[model samples]
Structures are given as structure tokens and as C-alpha cells.
Target: MFKKLKITCDEATTICDKNQYGEATLLEKIKLNIHFIRCKICFKYTKQNMTLTKIYKGHAKSCKELKHCLSDTDKEVLKEKLNSFKV
Candidate 1:
């Protein structure tokens, strides 16, 4: 039953990481686009993963410039937001 699906674990991981950063190669993006067209589960998974990454990265940026700029409350909030992404 899985024969028709062309995606592999390695490809999926690469695609997931690249897609998270919006830096995937054209071919890689095309392949993922095609796969998402046919696979709702994979598509939703990828979308959520990317969204979580963006949120985490955005939160990180709030404290990235200064080594000691983040207050305890800020760190705790960022950590909480990032940890929320875990399954």
C-alpha cells in the first residue's frame, strides 16, 4: 500500500528542515509540493512543524543579540513557547 508514496525518511527530514527555513532547493520544494498534494497527513505535519519552527526562531531572535539581555521571565516564556512544539 505504501508503494505509491515516493517519500522516504531522509527526504522527508531534509524537506522538513529546508521547508522550515524557506530555503529548500527548487527540486526539493517541488517534490514536497507534489507529495503534499496527495498526502493530507504529511502536508499537515509539515505545515505544523514549519509553523512551530518559525515561532521558536522568532522567539529566539528576541534575545539573540545580547548575551545577557534576556530577563528570567523572558527566558522562561521563550522556553515555554518552544517546548510547546514537542509532541
Candidate 2:
């Protein structure tokens, strides 16, 4: 029952966020696993956080591809036109 987990809910949350970004250490991930096993709330939060991160990552990748679809010259021309319209 989480006796060896040695992590608080806040720490679990931090670890979950770090795990999403691939920054969590193995030790941290182990601790998070223990915490999630004992804490339904933390498990739910972790699941939701993972879902949102995936959605956001997908959107970001698509946005980057869309932006690159425009050539550099087209971008420069668009930027100049936008600047001229700025009142």
C-alpha cells in the first residue's frame, strides 16, 4: 500500500508531467506507479494529463507542417503585407 512509494500527490503530479515530456527518471516513474496504484485520483489525473498532452502534441506537429508549407519568400511577402496593414 504505497508505504515504500515515498511520494506525495504533488510529487506524483510533477512526476506525471515530467513523464509526459520524457524527462522523468526511472526512479521517479517507479514512484509514480506506486502512487497511482494506491491513489485513484492521481491515476485519473495522470490519464487526463497524458491525453491532453497527446492531443496538443498532434496539433503542434500539424501546425508546424502547415507553417512550413509556405515558402520563405511567401512568408516574407505576407509579413510585409501584414506590417503595412498594421495601423
Candidate 3:
């Protein structure tokens, strides 16, 4: 029954993280899905985890396509500003 398939919140979170990395087994995923049916907090955590993963992936992909480098003058100005902030 569903009771037999239930997993603890800690285990669920671990499995959720593994699933994010494509490392979870089919049985672990099944248990996680079953756990999600009854635990709103775990469900929310999984949703947020997926959102963060997507955001990070998007940022990483975009970063590869964009290049930003400071000129020597800009670097000198930054160094002076940083020096002024020193104790």
C-alpha cells in the first residue's frame, strides 16, 4: 500500500536532490512521488529546488555567450576605490 511506500522527510529531501542531478533510481523517484502526495512542505521544497536549478542552468548558459571585461583605466579606478575602503 501507500504506507509501505512512504519515505521520511529527510530521505525525501535527499532523493529530491539526487533527482535534480539525474542520479535517483526509479524506486527512489516513486517513493518521492508518493511522499509528495501527502507532504506539502516537501512538495514545496522540491518545487523551489527545481526553480533554482532552472535559474542556475539559464544563468550558466547565458554567461558562456556574454563577455564583459574592464579596461585598464577601469581596473585602476576600481583598485583605487577598493583601497579607499580599506581600514
Candidate 4:
């Protein structure tokens, strides 16, 4: 018998969050993958999550370099602007 398989948004989010760090079990990953395959929104979400994670990791690797690359004048200007907003 073919039973209905429906996953909730909260369940999908939980699965995606667990899979983010490569810590999910094989069965969990497989179930999430199946759900993703059947759900367009979940698929898009998973794709975006993967893309953002990659971007974040790449940016993290060059964070020190990125900071150093900013000109002193730019940094000073940003700091002054930020200070003006403090209550």
C-alpha cells in the first residue's frame, strides 16, 4: 500500500537545520532529500541555505584580509557614522 507522505514546514526546517552541519544521520538525510524532491519551496530553501553557507564559509576564511583591505579613512568614517546612531 502507498501511504501518503506529508511533511510540515516546521519539520522541513528542523531537518534542514540538522543537515546544515553535516551532522544528520543517513536515514534523516534520505528522508529530507525525498521531501525536498517533492516540495519546490523546500528545495529552493535548501539550495539557498547551501549557497549562503558556502558564501559565509568563504567570507570567514578571508575576514581578516577583508578587514585589512578597507582603507583607514573608510573605517574611520564608518566608525563615526555608527557612533552617531548610538543612544
Candidate 5:
């Protein structure tokens, strides 16, 4: 019963990721929802994950119409940005 449903935060996070990609089973979803009952932090994490996925899906659809590669100038700018980020 309760013992079967009980999951650690790590397992909960994994299940949450699986759920994002539609890989989680119905039982896993049930267990995760049960986990949310007592764990606010994991619940918050799932909410944030869902939000990010939603945003990414919308952005990806728009990006499909855009170019697939950067130009020489664009590559140079990106290289400069990366070099600036390095110590």
C-alpha cells in the first residue's frame, strides 16, 4: 500500500523526467502524484519541468522553419561568447 507508493526524491525526479517525455507508466504517475501529497519540492520541480517542456515545444516548432546552421560570422560571434565565458 503506502510502502509501495513511497519514493525517494531521486526516484521522484526520475519519474518526473519520464513523465515529461511520455515514458512514465500510469502506475508511476499515480505514485508521483501520491508523492506530491507530502513533498512540495518535487511537486514544484515537476511544475517547472512541465513549464519548460511546454515552452520548448512551442519554440521548437517555430525553429523548424529557421536555418539549420550558422554562418561564418555567426560562428565567430559564438566562439567569442564561449571564450568570454571561460576563465
Candidate 6:
């Protein structure tokens, strides 16, 4: 039945996120695609999510080659901030 394949926008988005992370099952992805057929908003969200993931992955590859660290003053400031947050 068509009802078996139907998914809400919220479910579509969750599946989209899981698909991005390679955590969605084949059935979920299929349902997501089915949902996208009639829902342009969910389709756009999936497109944007894929774009952001691609951009982050590209940035991550380049970032690993470079070393980044805070200076002693910055570290002390961060430590003070964390210490203040402690109950």
C-alpha cells in the first residue's frame, strides 16, 4: 500500500541526516526518496544537508594537515571559563 511508503517531513529529515552519516538503512533511504517525490521542502533540506556535509568533509581533509593550538593566555582564559562553569 502507498501508506506503507509514506513518511512525514520530520521523518524524512531524520533519515536525511542519518543518510548523510551513512547510518540510514536501505528501507529508510527508499522511504526518504519516496517522500521527496511530493515534498519539495524535504528535497531542498536533503540537498542543503549534503552540501554542508561535503563542505565540512573538504575542510576536514585540509585542516588535518595543519596544526592549530591556543596560546598560553588563551588556554588560561579557557581554563578560567571552564572552572567558572563547574558547580
TM-score of every candidate: 0.57, 0.67, 0.63, 0.57, 0.68, 0.67
How far residue 56's Cα lies from its native spot in candidate 1, in Å, is 1.0
The TM-score of candidate 2 is 0.67
Give stretches of model 3 more than 4 Å off.
Answer: 1-4, 62-87
- Residue 69 displacement in candidate 2 (angstroms): 12
Using lDDT as the measure, name the better of candidate 1 and candidate 3.
3
Candidate 5 colliding pairs: none
lDDT of each: 0.76, 0.90, 0.93, 0.77, 0.94, 0.94
TM-score of 3: 0.63
Can you list the residue pairs that collide in candidate 6?
Answer: none
lDDT of 4 at 83: 94
C-alpha RMSD values across all candidates: 13.2, 6.0, 6.1, 7.2, 8.1, 5.6
lDDT of 6 at 30: 92
Report the lDDT tens digits of candidate 4 across residue range 1-87: 112345676777678877888887876676677787678898888889898889887897888565546889999999999999894
| Residue-by-residue lDDT tens digits, candidate 5, 11-62 | 9999999999999999999999999999999999999999999999999899
TM-score, model 4 to reference: 0.57
Candidate 6 lDDT, 5-63, residue by residue in tens: 89999999999998998999999989999998899999999999999999999999999
Score residue 27 of candidate 3 by CA lDDT: 92
Error of 4 at 57 (Å): 0.3
Q: Per-residue lDDT for 7-71 in model 2, tens only? A: 99999999999899999999899999888778999999999998999999999889888643788
Candidate 4: misplaced stretches above 4 Å? 1-6, 64-87
Q: Name the top TM-score candidate.
A: 5
